[model samples]
Target: MSDAPKAANPTGADPEANQPGLGDLRVIVANHLKRRLPGRSTMREDVAAGMSIAVGNVPDGMANGFLVGVNPIHGLYATIMGPIVGGALSSTQLMVITTTAAASLTASQPLADMPVEARTGALFVMVVLAGLFQLLFAVLGLARLTRFVSYSVTTGFLTGIAVLLILSQLPTIAGYPVLGANRVMQTLDLMVHIQEVNPAALGLAVMTIALARWLPRTPLRGFGRLVAIIIPSLIVALFHIDGVQLVRDLGEIGRSMPTPDMPSMLRLAPGVLTGALSIAAVVT
Candidate 1:
């Protein structure tokens, strides 16, 4: 039987058993929880803000999942969990931690080659791996590297992502799924088949965009996006609009929360590993 006390690292940054200290993540969270609670007025504002964020994310989350080539429910689930986890660990105060179109686009690339049935499981694995990579970056304190990245490179990267996202959505907006080797080729194919565009779907998409832009100027600004989703959905149902795809069209959204599943070890190969690293880089 060993009687010697375990060695304690002075930094207490790691989760090792012997190194419990103020720097421990658990301690930090506990301290945060014990801090002065917000006053009633502040709490009311927080609740209102949270509700607004939830309403706004309903469509955005599903859209992200759709972009990832998986069931939209998964994205909705991410919207639910991502904020809880992100808020817990987040170091910054200015940003809202949630999914983004760029990261979704980056995630889609890896799943593009996967079968429909397999993509969901593969996505789960990829996400877990990406989280690990991001954690590694934090542990290594590599955030300082971003300071050295050139302004031109950052600007170009963002512009490229935005342009690609816009091009990628053209097919959906046109109610045509133009299949090609990549987004650029698909966009070209979509351009070539301009006559095949569904006027009904295009009209609705335009109206939705207009609503998104116009609503933000009024008192209903905070609810604009949420209303945009609901309004188009009601019209789609009432008119029985065909050709345009939807989140529900991709897969079933269950009535209850899904059972948590283990990430598929089969998907941990080099290709997926690279995809995970790509997602991590884009997300960070």
Candidate 2:
């Protein structure tokens, strides 16, 4: 026999040849699941981190849900279920799945036309459809399409989203009703009604914003956002700030855990499709 070792398989074949039919798919699935599983050594740390993230994310999720005109409890539900399901299936340990301002804003547009009572069902459909589209994209290997989007375009898009988020929340922050369907009209309406702004509400908003910004610089930074929201809210309540609205004013928050149910597919309309696509695009 020659001293030299046999040449390696150019096709990356196993030395012990096995059946190629279902074995390849099985290997793929096994590898996927393996990546998703937490290692025994890191289990404690993983659980701690997950708990921290879940708690830290609740306020933002609730805000997004409110902005989307849904019951605030829906936001809490989205935050809880999303991370658990996403964490279990995702390959990356650090990947977080939660409601975002952009997704909520995009979803709100199409939902604007629906009756207040029916908006919740429409929101559910939009979210489900968006998830389905994402799965379709993954199966079709369309992730590479993102490469065609230029960096400048992405920056501008994100900047626009940030502006929209600020504008959308301005009414709430200023203690006024969201005046118009479009941002331009809303801005104009806000300007026209500038004198009607509630002083107490504005002060609370200012205090919350200031604390939220400054608290992170302190030693207790981990709880900055939560404290920022809670302290201002407590002060407002204690002082009995007149003309200031609280979350309790919106509707009764559901106390129980959310259960899964099918969305009303019969209500799907052309506008709903457009909104679903917009949400998926923003999420991606």
Question: Compared with the true structure, what per-residue lDDT tens digits does model 2 show for residues 109-143?
Answer: 88877777778888888888898988888898987
How close to the true structure is residue 159 of candidate 1, measured as C-alpha lDDT? 98
Superposed model 1: Cα runs more than 4 Å off:
1-35, 267-270
lDDT by residue for model 1 (155-234), tens: 89999998988887888889887989998899999989999999988998899999988886888877888788889989
- Scored by lDDT, model 1 comes in at 0.80
Every candidate's lDDT: 0.80, 0.77
Cα displacement (Å) at residue 229, model 2: 1.1
lDDT, candidate 1, residue 246?
71
Off by over 4 Å in 2: 1-44, 267-269
Best by lDDT: 1
